[model samples]
Target chain A: MSGAKRGGIEVLSGNDMCVEGALAAGLSFFAGYPITPSSEIAESLSSILPRRGGCFVQMEDEIASLGAAIGASLTGRKSMTATSGPGYSLMQEHIGYAAMAEVPVVIINVMRGGPSTGLPTKAGQADVMQAAWGSHGDYRTAALCPSSVKECFETTVKAFEWAERFRIPVTVLPDEIIAHMRENVDTRCIAEAKPFDRLKPGKPPEEYEPYSYEISKEGAAIADFGRGYRFHVTGLAHDATGFPTNDPEEISRCNWRIIEKVEIARSAFTWTEKFMLEDAEILVFAYGSVARTAKDAVLRLRAAGIRAGLYRPVTIWPFPASEAREVFREARKVLVPELNAGQMAGEIEKYLTRGCDVEKINRLDGEIITPVQIMEAAKALHGRKKAQSSD
Target chain B: MAGRRLSPAIDIEKYLRKRNLPHIWCAGCGNGIVLGALLRAIARSGFRQDDVAMVSGIGCSSRLPGYVDFNTLHTTHGRAIAFATGIKLGRPDMHVIVVSGDGDATAIGGNHFIHACRRNIGITAIIVNNYIYGMTGGQVSPTTPKGSRATTAPFGNAERPFDICLLAAAAGANFAARTTAFHADKLEDLIFKGLGRKGFSVIEAITPCPTCFGRRNQNPTGVDLMNLIREQSCGIEPGGKSEAPAGIRLGVFADRDEKEFTEIYAEMAAGAGR
Candidate 1:
């Protein structure tokens, strides 16, 4: 069952687009386990990757899936894995391992309602905070939120780019709504986009150091195994030579580099989708599936002669704080409409300037927040603003 | 066993990272001897240094990877096999070997170990079964003897220990063998044979953690533990076709030709032309 397409466009679900995006980004290996709302990505890659001379493995479990992906990545293959909330939780340890060992891997989490397997088949965006700090210890990696099917593809590619560029695990967060929703995706631009490759050791194998703290200058540049550069890789704190170390100075240097690499490259990959924000007093902050609803709500509010604008942070982590500060500068009031109970609203509150009232509309009962709910929240926010102005 | 040559004629020093030593194993730990056997096996194997990847999980035995100079990866606890599985699948041409402790392999990493055997991928798993979690201060592990004393089981363990070789054989590994740190020559020979095999091969090397395990047990020294291992083990007779004895037997428990996992995947990948 497929929809009609014009030119280079094809109808695909968000998960299907993730597969397409991974292929476009030179994904050479994939190991995954099936989970709700994210199974299609693994199923599609199983048939496609092998055909394209890439490798695919359905690992024993979620933990093994990411463990295998990390191993494949060490061999200079662009590797990835997909999962839902519970599976993502199981992958947290390896996520930390990948970060500590400086392995470039891409993980796609199709967000579902959960503290523990809450609603597997339904949609939710509650994994936003977990995406940032789920794994223990300090490490920075890009987490991208794609609102639409086309962005699902583009954002998947972007995730790979940042993973390779920063030599760290990058996560693509797509809520269950976007994961299952099908739409016609124009893939011409994405197809032609050049994929980023991880930096290889340019020096002789004898002098090559697999890790270093040149965060402002370069990301992790490593040599693939079997290429004659037999450097050690470990999850423990390590020195520039890639061997484990206990020296306090060396440990500090290693930790700071992995965290700062993403911060240094933030300007290049950080992005936001703004709709009619020039002189708007009420700013609507949202992302993922909620962002799409927010857009609809913003349009309706504008049609009703109220200045409401939608601001969606495409790159959710390395959290666009500077841009949030700039965008929230002119707004008198801000409204966050999300699936979770104020997960990202609290983050938005962190960046909003003084005197700006932040209102949150949360729905956690396995349902999407409708445009009407957002419009009502915006009206209330506007009424509060008017009352304050009159006083 | 009085005058046996534990060290091989090959230059194992070339295989070691001299700067990283002296190793972190305890004063009387048998891990050093096990590491010596592994080095001899690797030295005897025909594979080039660059083509071998030594992966280990967190443990005293896992620290052996750091001392050697191959493409070593000291990963998180209980994930060395999973990581080695990926490396083998990624580069079928590379010789991937995993070194994990008893608790790391048979407990936390049990699922991956059994699955790897079922898949029959070409990975040599040298499970250093010290009977307890030596790195974590002598906690009773999956392979700890039912009546053994550990820090976690001070009153003696009630849980039965696992026959790791039998477990590997039952899980469908192409090759499964058993030897001890005291049988250093046999340990090296078994490891070499495991490396030469086509699919998933397992060698459970019973070694001693004198500091953790032996301190609480009757055997308080490495020499005492070595003598205890020597006395308990029985060698398999040549041309024996009977089932393995219920106790520890020092020989190959299983060996058969099987279609390897990586080769099947490689064939499919090659056939799936762009």
Candidate 2:
């Protein structure tokens, strides 16, 4: 396989962009299992990471892949892992562990159609819910969705930054379409995205406590292994020193701290691309690869003299709820077209005000929700809104 | 824990997180003995405390890391070896040790355990074979001998037990050995050799779970279980044959030079970078 040469503009698939993004984000280790749609990420990183003074390992399974990445991250390395639908399902256990342990790790899930191996080579946004609630816990993690190759690279870099800043695993979701589709991306522009790393313990080893909020208000300030800090990290609910505790107050604080920390930084993590959303009566909400098609439909609808606009959320989870509320405030009609069976639509419905006519077009036959289909739904939604307004 | 002194010269308190103790392991449980052996081994290895990282999965044995004053990580159940693989690869200079239970290593985490051995990635896996899941309350584990009674196996365990050392050797670990908690000195020695080895090392420490495994079987107390283990185990002869009956054979099973994952990776990585 030919590698992407550094510098200048290059045509690269989303998976290739992930490798470039990971490298740009100062990734020092990657451990992943080979799965369709996401395998290219593991394949590319396997060679590239080691060359850059990093380590890449093809782990035995998806669980181990995330497990290894978490371990590496704990040792003061910016580590990541990539996988697909079934593989993502396999990683949920460790995902919760990473959250509970407050390990900074990046996990990229190249979305494909599936409850289990439903469609390996095709795209689907069905994992939207899974990305948010796959792991059983009261926790929150930043999840990013990139619609194009360039966005893929940029978003992957941002994923690392968020993971580091929050001391939690951040997921980057790009469907099989975005993962395999090649597009032109400027290396210089993507490189401009800044990287973030966790805060290291500022005090002496003897004086340091691993998870003391009094030490740092942002990310975890635990010391790395072999650095003489000699701290403990555990998946069980723990006290400030990172030791397991059965105390109700300590456990409640541990659970709430992980969830509320991300929630507090919700505004910083919320990101969206509003296309012609100004004064548009018909606002279409979508994300991931399908958002690209929705944007196209919005453009086509505008040409046909329909007041349509696209609101695409790059940060899929933590849902950009406030922006959705503000954007949907004045719109008379809203439409959500997705590759899944109305997953994002349900999320959209949660934020909209009463009396707004909303419609959703869902496709689950391993085919993308085409722009024509979205335009039809938007037109119908617009028609109902217009008829009601006239009455 | 109050009166018994396993090794007087080692100054074991220096290697302990005293504030986090009294450990949660049940009374008469062999996890404490295994932990004591591991500590003694670490002391003998002469590695800097800062240069050692102890990782463990969920179990009574896995809880050992919490009581140790090292760069310890208590990860999810069945994933300690996988996590240790990452630590060893990330910082090859550090000595990484994984303390796992029989169930943690061979049941839910069986795939990762075998793959870690295959990679030979310079991790010392101290699989504490208590033959039952002590943390979860006497459940039948993958290492529980056939016909053994457990909470889950009210009648008797029908599945065959895994010989952890043989499994490690066959799976391509560079060093593999089996020693019981009753043989504390031997367990310490074996763990020391495992720490010194340059590739994946597996030390299956067969310890008693007096609260769970022992009470269900005929061995009711920790001492009884230790005596049972002492009676069943015999060292390998010079010719590598054991004269003991069909019981647990305790000795080194494999030790040979092979390319370790980190060294090979580093060499290859060194050549590729600009």
Candidate 3:
């Protein structure tokens, strides 16, 4: 699909670009069961994949979708699956398996309202925590947030790279708006960006320990079946031998590798966009589609002679606390306008400093936090800061 | 009796992980015999050991993957077939086999099992039906016969058991068969034949759980359980089988030629390229 012709902008929904992004990232296998808003990704890929020599399988359920993806990843192919809230819940079991087995697979969880199937078509950022802690036990993973159609395509490509880089399942969170909203997308840059494929063991079967940590600084090599790597892989905690082990010290050593490898790469994996923070006295923190509205609020406050900036974290998990620390250092107040009730704001509060006052502008009734709402919240904070500084 | 000594012709030691010697199955447990037959089948199937992948869900029988020297995957409860289906589809070159228990394969993983059969994926699913959940201490299972006692069914199992072979046949599998662990030679042959088939194959290998299910009934020892199976079961004629009796059948019931899932998928890929 890549050519040396002229490039132009075209209108495509975020979900449509998600499929395009996956194709561009060298994804050859997609196993997904449909859910609302996110269903278009599967539907589009169903026809697109077969035409491009890739496989698109509609599994019986959500659990099987990720199960198949994890299964496919063992063959050393980049694989992906998509779902919404309830489907994401069912996928948690296999997500844990993918983590424990160190399988590189990408999961696209289109955020929708929920404690349980709360809103099928509406957007919410409630799954941010779920994406981090949804799977059981101790493991470290990366979750990327895409706020627009362009980011959907770009971040998905990056998600595959991150998953392959760390040998962990990476989540790409796009909300209902970004998933369905049609926007101008330029496809030229994607053709040039290279996707990272994890290293495979060059060592012979005799010397290969599949879970051995000494191979690469990023992660260990995963040898494919029939290539004579003939290794044992399981979900239970194991030693470097890739077999189950109950030893406390070896378990810690095994556990720390998955976490340390990802943690070491955090600064490189973390992506945050900052706007107008050079001389700002107030700040608004947001992500996903809500970040777009937060930007509008920032612009409105700036136009009104109020020094306010926006910190939009493109990488949500691995928290981006370091990036936020830079913002908190300058702004006297921080406003977090989330679609959920203070989920991201609660996160920001954890890394938040002593002098900065935090204001939460949350909407939990299956509605987006509008720019007007964020503008009002930022203005109120700006006014308070202006008052304090004048005194 | 089904256990009457039939000399095992193949050398099974080389296929096993010698370091993990002395498996976890109980002394009289039939899992060992079934596992031995599977290893022999793998040895004689003409497929390279590296080209074969054994996927299993959680259970006593599911531990087979840990003992074998191959590309083994130990998955969650009841999802072995699902994961195997993925492995078969992803590579389309490897021979994927699922080794799981009745409770894991037919109960919790029942939906995935039927769908895999329906898709007719090129994977052989070997289901070990021990009539009771052995790992959890004698709980009722999907293949537990009616009126049988279990820890879950103290008085008696009021529910009806599933006929795994028939279910596979109904779900459009190309091959389906049932045999007991005691009939090691026949079961191995059946598995070899199933692996030889192009599409999905389900072999319900009835294994005795004397420590769990056998003592619940009067058959306390593993030998007693095998003797009971020999006396109570009937051999089905080719293409002649019924599920009503809930007894083991000692031969292949259905073997047909059908276009497998991966073959069809490959055809699409080739056509797409053209």
Q: Which should have the higher DockQ, number 2 or number 3? A: 2
Rank candidates, DockQ, best first: 1, 2, 3
lDDT by residue (A73-185, candidate 1, tens digit) is 99999999999999999999999998888899999999999879799999999889888898999988778999999899889998998888778888999999999999887
Q: What is the DockQ of each candidate?
A: 0.80, 0.77, 0.73
List native contact recovery per candidate, as a fraction of 1. Answer: 0.89, 0.85, 0.78
TM-scores for every predicted model: 0.97, 0.96, 0.96
Interface RMSD list for the candidates: 1.2, 1.1, 1.5
The DockQ score of candidate 3 comes to 0.73
Q: For residues B30-142, what per-residue lDDT tens digits would candidate 3 score against the true structure?
A: 88888888887877887888899999999999989989888999999989887887888888889999999999998899999999989999999999999999999999999
Write one digit per residue (lDDT tens) for candidate 2, span B1-274: 5645555689777998888888887777888888889999899889889999999998888889989889999998899988998898889999999999999999988998999889899999999998999877899999899999999999999998888887888999999999998888778889999998999999998898889999999999998998999889888764346787368888998887798989988888888872
Error of 3 at B47 (Å): 1.4
- Comparing 2 and 3 on lDDT, the stronger one: 2
lDDT of 3 by residue, A226-345 (tens): 678888888878888788887999899888877788777778777989888788777788899989998888888888888888888999988876777766876668888888878877
Tens-digit lDDT track for model 2 on A326-362? 9888876888888888887887887888887878888
Clashing pairs in 3: none
